[model samples]
Target: MNGSGKDDKQRNRVIAKNEAERQTTGDIRVSAWTIVFAIIVGAIAVYIVWAWLHR
Candidate 1:
């Protein structure tokens, strides 16, 4: 009974660690995408402004 309990605890720990890692990776992916989107939008805005001013 004691050995079974220890095994359960170990399994739970592994699952929890996996979940935390997945969450962290998801957050990083979202942040990276946001940064990419911001850069693209900024470039477009600059281009529009330049074209308007020059023309």
Candidate 2:
């Protein structure tokens, strides 16, 4: 019974680790896309301002 309990605990730990790693990867991907979007928006805003000033 003790050996079975140990195996269960080890299995649970491995599952938890995999889940955490998956979440971390997802978060990084989202962060990268967010940065790209922000950069595009900023570029558009700058161009608009420049055109207005020139006109």
Q: Which stretches of candidate 1 lie over 4 Å from their true place?
A: none
* Candidate 2 C-alpha error for residue 48, in Å: 0.7
What are the RMSDs of all candidates, in order? 1.4, 1.0
TM-score of each: 0.85, 0.92
Instruction: Please provide, for model 2 over 1-55, each residue's C-alpha lDDT reduced to its tens digit, 9 standing for 90 to 100.
Output: 6999999999999999999999999999999999999999999999999999999
| Candidate 1, 1-55: lDDT as tens digits | 6999999999999999999999999999999999999999999999999999999
Model 2 weakest lDDT span, ten residues long: 1-10
**C-alpha lDDT (0 to 100) for residue 19 of candidate 2:** 100
Candidate 1 lands at a TM-score of 0.85
